[model samples]
Target chain A: MSGHNVVAEAFAQTQYQVGGHGKRIVQVLKDVLNEVEGTVEGDMYGSGKLIADFEAKMAEYLGKESAVFFPSGTMAQQIALRIWCDELGLKKVAYHPLSHLEIHEEAGLRELHGIESVLLGEKDRLIQLEEILNLQEEIACLLLELPQREIGGQLPSFEDLQKISAHCREKGIRLHLDGARLFEILPYYQKTAQEVCALFDSVYVSFYKGIGGIAGAILAGSAEFTKQSKVWKRRHGGDLISLYPYILTADAYFDQRIPKMGQYYEQAQELAGLYNQCPRVTTWPEVPVSNMFHVHVELPKAELEPILAAVYAETGVGLTPYVREYDESTSSFEVGIGDRYAQVPKDALHTAFRLLHEKLQNL
Target chain B: MSGHNVVAEAFAQTQYQVGGHGKRIVQVLKDVLNEVEGTVEGDMYGSGKLIADFEAKMAEYLGKESAVFFPSGTMAQQIALRIWCDELGLKKVAYHPLSHLEIHEEAGLRELHGIESVLLGEKDRLIQLEEILNLQEEIACLLLELPQREIGGQLPSFEDLQKISAHCREKGIRLHLDGARLFEILPYYQKTAQEVCALFDSVYVSFYKGIGGIAGAILAGSAEFTKQSKVWKRRHGGDLISLYPYILTADAYFDQRIPKMGQYYEQAQELAGLYNQCPRVTTWPEVPVSNMFHVHVELPKAELEPILAAVYAETGVGLTPYVREYDESTSSFEVGIGDRYAQVPKDALHTAFRLLHEKLQNL
Candidate 1:
């Protein structure tokens, strides 16, 4: 096995690990599946009580007049931008350069919708209100990922967000919130989902990220925007014969975990502090604004692999499963706090962090 | 309740109703879920053993080198056409006017990919070889829906299909088969799935249709075509965090129901004959080309609704749950034979048909 695989495998076997709600496995859906009555009718062609109720609940939670469930956030976000573009009679939208649409979707927005994107900000930071106020392109929508997940979950101040939202509104450009990790930021924002979502014209939140559902998304907005989204949903084939499998789990997990955001945020801050204590290791933002952050170590990824593996073997605590080469000499990895952190034995976590710190000092 | 709702409710309660494999409900996935080990890892980001194995299995079954699992046939079929268009460096394709892409997808093909389509055949019949021979426009792909579904599961002779395939190949136009109900037609064609699939450059099969899966589709074709589809799949957001829910049910039901296509075909022939005996009722094509056929009645839909409801009430057997208006004085309904037909008592079925015939005679 390569160094990456060796570290990942060793992390998998560690007695305790920190990150994610749980392993992404079939067992994650067991809680909801076991309660499903086989005889009860599932939604057919996107209409049924199960899906309708969940959509309604999410819409109400997000303080939107309407909402539609989608098979993936990827589809929901694209359609959201598409709807705005169509409504405004323009085929352009703008977002951060590091946005998921630019980085991950393989040019779906460009190839599928014939919509052009003006990547607005530098790759390393969140979009600023100054950038929104001076967009050179006549764009239909301005998409903002709350907590800017790509940059170590760094979030802008709420006041700056309001200013950005107002400027977009005044400019007749739709403001869309890519709130895939919206739930994780609620504790830090000190806002209800509705309060935070109210700042944007539309919101797309995910069920699989922080909420830990199997997989699903909700696009919420005005009734008109949602009505338009349905057409695009069917166009994108998001209208499956049924989505009850995703709905039931999303509903169950949303109720069980929405209240745990505060605890997860606390865990993230505590964890980041521990990593920052190490000599050569530091966290972006020096503290976490939500339930996730990034750890940067001033060591080559190749050299850091053995240290992480050995730490897992000796301390029975795994920090991260893999290291990403940040540059020639720097290594990095992302961390998301979830149910895994609370389960770790307190002393073992401290011992592991102490060893990690000592190792970083020597390096 | 409306007449449609009353008739639908009555038919749903009948113990001897035929058409479809059980109800399109949660129970259809039970057999699979009961056998799944919760701890077994599910596919993540469209990779993992489960999805890979299922795609490989489908590819082998379809006599193709590769296959991809999509959340819906809509996404898969569009992607297939798009890939072919891109491969040939043309942005145009052709299909029957009644093809799902034309009639049902809200113009996804045109709007999403900016690909124009030429409707080659009349709406009322299958695309003929003559149309393939006489191409009025240059096209990248020609999509053929085997056993044309909207016009009531009518199919041209297999010889004509081979001829059309040859014409398309000679013209350097890729042929794609929208075989959503591919398995059902196998018995009628007296051909293996591979044998039929060999006629097309790409094939899209729906597990949710005749296979009675929850909701999933396979796009099978050459290694090169299938490789390109993955990029488009991600763009369409069909690449969910995991598709194991759809995969598990599709895999299980495909195994359980594939061999029963012959039995279902036989039942369809028998049922169509009974419907043909009624005074104002007739089966399209006079006989089923597969396990499905459309029933046309000389009476208006409003008038036929009560008559069908009465037959269901009197004989405890339901002919159809809904009637679609075919014209000013004609009404129609569709039927597909499955396990439900086998469960219905023979005596009750005969009695129901007798009542139906008598009611139609009076009308």
Candidate 2:
């Protein structure tokens, strides 16, 4: 009950997922491969026209002078920070404490690249402008993760972001955006991907997250920056003999999902309202700025799991199998609305939520 | 005539290749995916049954206690070296001057890992035992590449290799094998893959090279070493969400081609003999020790290219599209014999060689 097997079993028994299911993912990859004609070149190394074309398309979409594809977002972000720090001859970078680089990447920036991080801002909140102003040490770069994922997709206002960007410019510190969910947040800002990206010196986007590619990320910036990144990419062993599968999937997903961000965001808001109505349930943000928000319930994961399982058995609709424990009696889970959620009629979604609330009350 | 375009054009028109064609590679990937039933789980990170199974198979084949998959040989080897150097607290690694880390990786070992290299031997030759004895500094690891790829697939005698291995053991230095072409060289050593690997503390092999996988490398060693490598691999951004494609292709190729390496080596010897009989041509070692050898033609690449093109046009037999320039007049190209080469009739191959010699003599 406490290992990966439990999670795997829960996921297997679930009838629905916010993201596309395994069969759909495989079909997408197969379809993309079929659509692209001619022999897939580049052997085992990630080169050839396919990779070049995908990078070019991403650069054009992000309104950057150039772009490079990386096998993972962790690598893309680390390399971007490394390039900025090395160029300025400084090793100190500033970012929110909840940043992926700070918390998830095992401090590779410090251990591998010899770059120190100056953590700013409070936990579970958007980094305020004063956090930047309060920094006394000379930092080479500042990384901003839009709609901070670890904190329930919270985002700063457009005005606050612009002020932060202006402050970094005044201080001559490079700004890098960990825009892993940039597309998901764009609708709230009423901005184009390029408009949001232009505020930073470099931007990284994950194709596999909201865009639903199997795996890949694109780092876009000025031509010089991207050119240097390629060398670092090679050094980091990020350069594969071929990235055709990831590239084709990313391309297909961009076309299918990016334009519909607004609808997904609206669905998230509607979903949040349903959770809010249940006296035992509350949302972290009370509303969603993007297509994702965290839902907190009074019951712990152990008690909540079986109730959800019972609900699924009775209604044929699957809620989350487990919740992330927040306290002795409270737990939370992220609700990520995508094309799959959008396909379900609103009334069915309402019935599912009601059944979950009723089951929780009985438990 | 001198750039990649010419090479691409020639390859496009040629009916034969040292490796399987693009369609065949794609089909193999598809076939493997189809054969594996059920959802290939692991989410967007490589931590599932497929990756574990592949690693286990590789470990068993290499006679190692454990093995791990890396996205690139460059990353796998660098991580292996880093672990060894850190354990010994010595930053210096010994390798041949023409080693891939020394010449091809843009000094990433020094720049990224802070590991210095003690160049061990002359170019196009194996590292001698005397070279190891002469080193003054405390060395962390000694890297040996089987069939020394950069020098047209050259290998030392078994006795010499044993001497070097014993010396490293005596010095208490870690021995690492850059066994990228391990399978191809096995026939010459008359050793099982595990037998050759047993001499080294750690060994790396490329799936894309002899095994004909799309892209991946395997690093094998003791379970403790491999466990440490997983952390390093994650830090290097090598843990993909799914490595199903690479694993499946590797599994398929290992079964199909590994048993046929002896035949490939014999064919390489036959091909080298034919080239040696031509007055304008010479094989680098006069004979191949593996399934590949360097072909040095007396004409410059520019002079030889058009003649090869003419032969391809008239005889439907494809000579190499271009040769790597060795000097002002002489040029060299690697002739790698694989299953694809095994498909070509001996008479057709001889015809291609005869026509190439006649055209080159005229030029």
Candidate 3:
């Protein structure tokens, strides 16, 4: 038995652990690990000054007139759509069916916010102008997720986005960007943050995603919109005293990691190309335009698990699709790049495939 | 110049340096530092496993079968009420008129959740059976914040709470406890955590406030309740991967600090006695029953700021109500026992009063 088997077997004993995933609990950090020593005092309601400073920096970063920090992007986006619907007296906001607001958010937009979402576009494709034109006039806004995640990290073309933006503006409907993965989208578009943000009335960004913070989000928009969001933020218990820790982390990553996104983007293309060459693997949408892409593997769902587990057990390399079994004959995986291994070497990919193939053969 | 003036002036010029309160910013943590880490990585979604574990522990601690974590107690409580309203097929949640949900949340209960809040308590007291006897059938749940925060940290008598719980049971309405400051309420009730938690179907607790984690919340209830909450949490974007940091922090605090509440309760009583002796400061409800109480001072609003600033400047003490003017003639402030200053001595209380009195006399 290898190191991973020992851990996996141990984790298998717990109700929460599944198939060796969500295992390896992260260590609790105590003591000052960063360059700053935070005050140990508890003041979560946040002072007025801290709120003002966080909003200012967020606005400046996204090139919006103002911003409000939220505990979750779901709340921020839901509130944004709710406010949009209220402002226009429209009943719905339109978006791709697989958008996080739709599939993942447990119908919060409908249940919590009371704003109905018009699911446009094909079930698995990115939203397009054809979908928009077919929508009824009651839509107060159209929410567009850059580099849509659910459809294997697919993105709409820049021309299509511009056309959609102009269409919404012409029709007197608001355009909101669910820019949770905006950082990943920027390199693909070769656009400045301001240029992309300028395309929407409001943009929602997460600090913890690519930026690597503990937990936080910024909802950037016009000063008026942000002020209204601040009220909602407080109401939602999103406000905290001395958001300085999250702010500091965001600042650190903004300077150190953000500039390197273009390199990561370039590397993603290289990685996708390597996976595409594997006989049993089919990469989504051909080329990688963003830092994320999904791969579909034609492998027996039951057979693939043990072999892949053995491979990870032998080598410290973990392959994703991390067991997203689509059916008995098919399974898929999504890859996210961070400050970890990027542009996986061809030999490693081959070795991984060999291990996977042998495992299926044994089965 | 006084030390505080010089430090405050320096901070003003330096844009208020981070990590200056408890210890110096060091590359390596020198002391134990109470196990709070200086930095966090990954988005809370992928990196917040600590949050999930914390929620589970919170559920166990509250004697609930399951739990979900949130960014803010305000959001957690609001969403809980909203969930109750939807599940029960009603549209109202009864709470105190001065509930944090109403005043502090910026009408979010109304604006975001679309669930109307029926204020049940008197303007200055906890809700009794009389307040809710007239409640219409539309009421879905009643929100009870043990030791209600806004009204000078007053609590309903234990028997009163039992009656209220019975009333909700009889009416077939759910009971949700906004137990944000619940740690302070336990000693007064002389009840164990399980005993108090038994009265409500759901409870919300804060990590940063009582537990001293960076930021997080736990909403606990039945297994079914938590399963539904997970969907609601994901919709609200609260689901994160590695919450180990918060979970560890909360766990460590629960182990090391929770057992010490009895001491804090005693010290709080001592501080209340000291404040009662101060002629210039009149405490609300005569004395504090728990770790928190309010002080009313007959001071001009503008004059109070400088005096409080001077006190904090002279000694690193943060006193609040520092100036909330009730009318033109009277002002009020709230005091809570924190880790840094567990108890405010009688002499220290006199010193703060004497300094304020001198400043007011001069004015």
lDDT, candidate 3, at A47: 49
Off by over 4 Å in 2: A4-11, A18-28, A42-46, A343-348, B4-12, B15-28, B31-38, B42-44, B360-363
For A144-260, candidate 1 gives per-residue lDDT tens digits of 998788789999999998898888888899999999999999999899999899989999999988899989999999999998899999999889989988988899899889999
Q: In candidate 2, what are the lDDT values of residues A1-363, reduced to their tens digit?
A: 457534435555666644332343345565555565444554345456767888899999899999999989989999999999999999999999889988777777887899999989888677888878888999999999998988789998998889888989998999999999999999899999888998999999998777877788999999999989988888888888776667767888889888788988888888889889876898867889998888888987777776666655655555554567878898788877777775656666677778877776775
Between candidates 2 and 3, the one scoring higher on lDDT is: 2
What lDDT is reached at residue B328 by model 3?
Answer: 85
lDDT of 3 by residue, A1-363 (tens): 233443344323322211111222222123113444443322235545545676687788789998877766877888788778878998688888888887777787887667887878886577777878667657899999887888777888888888888888989889999887888779889888888888899999886666655456789898788777776667655665435445544555666668777776776676677667666777775787877778777886555566556665554456652456667888676766665544345566556556755655555
Which window of ten consecutive residues has the lowest lDDT sum in model 3 chain A?
A: A14-23
- Candidate 3, position A238, lDDT: 61
How big is the positional error of residue A26 in model 3, measured in Å on the Cα after superposition? 4.7
Show the lowest summed lDDT stretch of 10 residues, model 2 chain B.
B17-26
TM-score of chain A of each: 0.98, 0.93, 0.85
Q: TM-scores for all candidates?
A: 0.98, 0.94, 0.83
- Highest lDDT scorer: 1
> Which DockQ value does candidate 2 get?
0.50
DockQ of each: 0.81, 0.50, 0.34
Model 2 reaches what TM-score against the true structure?
0.94
Candidate 2 backbone collisions, by pair: A44-A241, A45-A240, A45-A241, A45-A242, A46-A240, A46-A241, A46-A242, B44-B241, B45-B241
Model 3 lDDT tens row, B1-363: 233443244323321121111211221122323444334332345334445556666777788888876656776787788778889998888888888887777887787667887878687776776676667646899998877778778887888788888888998899999887787678778887779989999998876554555556788888887777667667655564344444554566566667666666676676666556655567765667666777776765555556666755554344552357666877676666655344444455556556655655565
- Of candidate 3 chain B, the 10-residue stretch with the lowest lDDT total is B15-24
